[model samples]
Target: MTAFQQQLLDVNGITLSIYSAGPDSGRPVWLLHGFPECWYSWRSQMTALAEAGYRVYAPEMRGYGDSSAPEDVAAYQILTLCADIQGAMDALGHTDVCMIGHDWGAPVAWHLGLLEPERVSVLGAMSVPFGGRPKRPAIDIMREANVGRFNYIVYFQEPGVAEAELNADIERSMRLLIGGNSDVFLHPKPADAQFLAGLDVPTTYPEWCNEQDFAVYLRTLNKHGFHGPLNWYRNFEVNWQSTEFLAGRQVLQPTLFLLGEDDPVGKLEAYTVKKMGELVPRLESHVLSECGHWIQNERAGRVNELLLEFLGRHYPRAGIV
Candidate 1:
């Protein structure tokens, strides 16, 4: 396996810790991790892609791990997040890339498809699906739809509220969230309930994540706290309003969408997948049965297989220098 290299890059006015592998001359494949996860989340995929002769660049995205966590809530806006990756690509001297993202990282990857259609040669996303810009802000829609219920996104709107609860017990928080059932996010809770209320931390780590893996996440979040990550949820409205020009835009790149059968996010986004054919003209999609939200980790071998096959078809590593 190619040894991974780590570096801190100053880009988009902040620093990002990037973990890369494979030959520098191999075609670049940028992996963007989602909320509460660092570059380490892509460990399995990075190794697989690197071994296949693809340069894999996975960054501890802004607001997580060793990456700079800007205090301003507005700083976590989608445009800025996408800009960070864009700037990184520029600094690394890669003009074209195979971009892939998971969870919150999915939105950034989707928007990058819109923001830099030509540069993102092919796109892959897990957990989240892009349905194009909505007519109204997502916060307002979520607010109304989840009225009289504890929607995590709405609960995260008020500054410092969710942060306090999540930061209080970093380990417990990570355990409950990473190993918790997806139904918790789908099922209605009392409007005033806290994020971690009623959820029990698992005594044992999920089969997908071992003690060493859990340790990395626990230590990373403990160091930075949940403030920066929660701030990501706070910027829904800002992202919606700022991307008005992208209202009808479609991701022209060859795209792949993967979701777990049991992922509540997938259930919530079933409509998007149905209509995705219109937005993503050349698209391939799959749903792994019995899997949950952490698709890559919970189903790492399968996820890597799918990703490598997709890249092999559309972004093959045979020719690039």
Candidate 2:
């Protein structure tokens, strides 16, 4: 743990702040964190992975933490996100590595399998499942699904609106979003619901989430703001347009999909499971009971165990280059 080192690496012209541990000579594992979270999201799982004979590198994606954030909405497109990881591979001098993503990061890993199939030895995604591209533009589809304010994706479509409201009270907003400060939407959401609005900020965070973890996100988001994170939603249409060539394509890499049974992702689990078997060719699935969207941190012990077992089963130490 104390051996972990934080440094900056230039990938595709974007400088990313990356935290890495374990032997440099060991097989590399790219640990990616999703929206509203930074590299710290992977903190709890690092030690276990490292001990299991893995070299883990968790990078604060562009627009999060001290990483370079491009202002152009086009910059955050899925292709660019894939390129970021490809560029990181190039910079690190590795032809490919096991790609593991949580939440928003899951899409990045899944798309990397599509865009650069050879660069990923295996794919492990959490919370979000890849059921292939949406039939139409995601935002348009989502907006139509819930024309009311309940659509957070649509709410994020507008740039400054979410930033101002979210940043006004960073601590409170984070407490609700990740810290479990309040579960306003614990009940079925209203027709017009806002993620941050009407949520109470509690003095304590969730049992799994600690003040130290909350503080890390608070400091990072307070500095960079939510514009970059929300930009991911803004690229829905463009990402679809760019990846149209991959309409029928499936992930050829061995895939591992894990999620919290209680996570909204469960709604699509059946479809995703079927899709994976159809397109992925090699797939494994697991759903931890009583868990939520934050699967990695929520169940760090099991995640590490699953991760090591998967890696050892797929790319054993003796086989690693």
Candidate 3:
């Protein structure tokens, strides 16, 4: 595996800690991680892609690890998140890139495809799919759908409430939250339920994440706490309202979407795949059987294979010229 070179750069008024590998001359591949996770989440894929001669860059997305965590809730809005990556790419001097993201990062990647089609040569997203900008604020939609139930998004709407519970015990929170399946969010809970109320803390880590990997996540959350991350969820309505200009815009880039069969998020968002197809014309998608939310980590080998195959076809290293 190629050793990662870490650097910090001021982008979009915030400093981002970027972990990069592979040759500087190789085609740029930006890996954006989701909430509660740092750049370390893409360690396996980073190694594989770097070894395959594709320069890989994974950043500790705002609020995680060494990246800047702004105090204001509005600072974490979706467009601002995309702007952070855009600025990072500008700082790196890369105009064209193969951009990929997972979970919350998926939305950023998808939006960037719309916001910068010519610059993002190819796009990939896992776990989450873009179904186009909603007609109304997403918070309103979630609230109506989750009425009389405990929806995590709705639960995260209150500023300090979820932060208090999640930050109470960083290690325990990381353990239970990462180890648990997506059903925790998919299934209905009482309206008064807390985020980590009844989840069990695993004595041993999952196969994809060992004690060492677990330690990295623990140290990260303990550093910045969950305020910045939870702030992401708090901006659902804000994101929707601000992105109204993208109402009918489609992400015209050659795209790939991956999902895990067992991921309850897939169940909750089954309709999105179809909508994504309508919104992303050149999209190629897949569902890895028996996998879950942590698609890249849980199925690193297959994910890398699919990514390499997809890139070789549409955004190959040799095609950069």
Per-candidate TM-scores read: 0.98, 0.94, 0.98
lDDT of each: 0.89, 0.80, 0.89
Q: Residue 278 error for model 2, in Å?
A: 2.0
| lDDT rank order | 3, 1, 2
Q: Model 1 over residues 1-321: C-alpha lDDT tens digits?
A: 558899999999999999999987789999999888888889999999999989999999888888999899999999999999999989988888999999999999999989998789899999898799988888898899988888888998999889889888888888888877875576677999988887767788889889999898887787789999988898888888899989998889999999999988888889987888898999899999889999999999999999988888999998563
TM-score, cand. 1:
0.98
Tell me the number of clashing residue pairs for each predicted model.
Answer: 0, 0, 0
lDDT of 2 by residue, 1-321 (tens): 437789898888788888998877778888889988988888877777777777888998878989987877788998888788888888888776888998889999998878777768888898877878778887787677775446566677877888888878888878778866214333347655566776667777877778777788888888788888889879888988888888988888888889887776555355665566677778888889878878888888898888888888886645555
Ranking by TM-score: 3, 1, 2
- In candidate 3, which residue pairs get closer than 3 Å at backbone N, Cα or C atoms, i.e. clash? none
- Candidate 2 regions exceeding 4 Å error are 181-193, 268-270
What is the number of residue pairs that collide in model 3?
A: 0
Cα displacement (angstroms), candidate 2, residue 203, comes to 2.8
lDDT of 3 by residue, 1-321 (tens): 579999999999999999999987889999999977888999999999988888999999999889999989999999999999999988888888999999999999999988988889899999999989888887898899988988888899888999999898888888887887775566667989997787777888899999999898888888899999999898888888899889999889999899999887788889887677888899999999989999999999999999999999998887552
